[model samples]
Target: MFDKIKNIFKSDKEENNVTHKNAPKEVTVPAHKIGPKSQDDTTTYVIIGASIAGVTAVKTLRELDKGAKIIVISKDENIYSRCMLHHLISGHRTIEGINFVDGDFMEKQNATWIKKATVKEIDPNNKKIKYEKDGKEEELAYDKLLITSGANAFVPPVKNLREAKNVYPLRNIEDAIGIKEQAKYAKNIVIMGAGLVGMDALAGLVEIDGIGNLSLIASEDRILDKQLDVKAAKAYEDKFGQKGVKIYKNRMASEVLIDEDGKVKGINLGNDEIIDCDLLVVSTGVRSNIGLVEGSGIETEKGIKINEKGETNKPDIYAAGDVTGTGIWPLATKQAEVAATNMAGGEAVIEDRFEFKNTMNFLGIPTVSVGFITPPDDTYDILTYTDGDNYKMAVIKDDVLIGFIAQGDISYVGPYTQLVKEKIKVDNLAERVFELGYSDFFKIKEDGQFEW
Candidate 1:
């Protein structure tokens, strides 16, 4: 094991030495060649969590420094698709279809893959972690560390919920596999939390070749209560309703009713409503995995607190992704690369990737939200136009644009959002401003119109 660890470093050192080796075999060799590669040879980047942010950051870091040693430690043996866990539950996608990258590809990067290993403790002083693999425990060291453990599904409060035999969480790949096998004959499928995951599951399940019936229980007044506002949520409700999605809102799951075998039979609501279901999928918001943070001396703000640079209060220990509570995917990955830069180079601050304004989803339902969605009173004016599935709404406060939501008709929202994000003034010509964009804002005073 020690030899292998030494080889990982040796190869890392040889990689740097190979470049200098091409200097010509005829060149005189100094007795003691003092070079950067000779001293402190290993440039290892140990990134915890091989999820979205971690994987993306590793790729970006390799692009930045191809020779760096990347070590990925994850509890799971294979990569799990988090974005499509709902798809797994709804039987839209299979486990094999989601995992694009595998073990063989990682081996090519000079990356060490540790599976089923739990990080027992993070020691910043030694720059190592006391981890347990298989049955034995060991300590691993690194020059730089990135914590991107992602998030976990919330455990709901319901009697017999924890004891239910058939009930399972659709948070991971295994959960999805279990649901697929166990939920085939489920007469009633009760899904809790009707948020994005819930809706995603609904889409996936409704398209399922099998599965009997689906029931959704949302705690809030509307589905996706956190993401969508009242009006927009209502639109989704109406659409899902047409598909036989029974929605029960403003009710909490107080207790889960089980049969004699402790198998899930029904869910009792706090409002004294009993709903029976064979399978239950709870998709509440995730809480950051902070067990590694509790005693690590790292800062915590709901999630692990790190600056835009992914640097923690403790030296050499940085965090990123969902655990960092940045809520910015692109930014978190960028932060990891920046941390790698500072670790490989010198002391530098990692800049925040982007403000928590909004982002561009690759494949989405044409929805765009920036700043505050719903404005207060008439002080914040709203101009909205809706034609069936297409909707665009903009809010203005104090002669300046404040918030906006655009769906379906978002092809023209690109330049408009750029202006808002840059805080450019748009109150001058608020009316008749739907023309491609305004030239006045760009300091284009040619008295001409937009360039199409």
Candidate 2:
């Protein structure tokens, strides 16, 4: 699937022998050189951020309207996937390897990319945005605007944590780079919040050599409390334990011990235990970057509020991805496509707002979780299948399969997700839920294609 999308992002520039490593930070394609603009193509689309959602929107807009003016302004100079930052930290992939798009993506789309620009203010009334790049401030006008500013990692309010040095969040490429550099010399490295990001930090650090003591702190009873149940989480936790990693569960950092140089020396836990540390990685959580639309009449609660069509309260304005607090990668891309389609005078709406589905492969163990991990009440029927190293659980309510989890072998879990998403009745198949596959729900059409 990713290979197909990557091919769509490729252009003739690849035939001309261009590489992302040598691609320029900025690319400006003349409007006249693109083609004769039509009446509908006169719209100017400006997108903020350069991550998955922003880039996906850019591609969608260009595909829908070839001659439309597309401008992508981003604070990051390099285009890389935040999800792959752990690979970068582990020295598994380079900066260019993490890029999701092709080297000539901007050039192929005929878009203008303003890299390393910090957007200071957005003026929805005037349809202009003020930004600074290389110490110079500039303003740009747009007919349609997209805010995919993404999110920032939340640093907990641990005592002295904010004021201490050698602390980082694994949300950006720079943060990963900093952690990688510091890991070479640090005597003790402690990561707070044993969520996916913190586990990613642990995964990356374990691959590197000369890393002294390593420990993980989780406020919950088990790691990945939200994504996995206790039994499922234990599978991964046991793997980490075998890697010589210390696990501290149901504990919070009460204070950050700082040396005279204002650097992190260790951490004081709520249980009155002190763990020595020279570096700390905070992976507690993430909050949307909704400050860009603060006074722009764009309604916001936990994040920038958008309708089903991804339209903001303001006219001609749309928001997607993490900026809307839809942190899931697939959902973000879907939202971007829907928003871009609407901006191109088309109609699209998000049908599936369900965000509980997630798949992860950590330490060679693949797991899939959809909907609820635990039943809200005893009214729901719970079924399980456990063998040696594999575990599977299904939560059924009435006749519908509401939740499901598969660990060790996720090969036949596709139908389970479909069952949960489509609210399919699985009364007859409840006993063999783990054995379900696409064949159970799909039939061959006249055209020799499978239809669901």
Q: Which candidate number has the best TM-score?
A: 2
Please provide, for model 2 over 332-394, each residue's C-alpha lDDT reduced to its tens digit, 9 standing for 90 to 100: 777887888888777788766777776777788878788887787899888888998899888
Clashing pairs in 1: none
Index of the highest-lDDT prediction: 2
Expressed as tens digits, the lDDT of each residue in 1-452 for candidate 1 is: 00011111222233211111001111111222222232234678888887656665565455445567778898877764465565566664566545535435467566787888877789887889877888898888988888888777777666788889777766678777777777788889888887666666666676667667788899988876654566767777776677777899987899989889889999898777889888888777678887876677888988888865568898878787778765444444456555654555533355434343432221235455666766657676777767887776766665566666666666655556555665556554256345435444555337764442
Which 10 consecutive residues of model 1 have the lowest summed lDDT?
Answer: 18-27
**Alpha-carbon RMSD to native, per candidate:** 10.5, 5.6
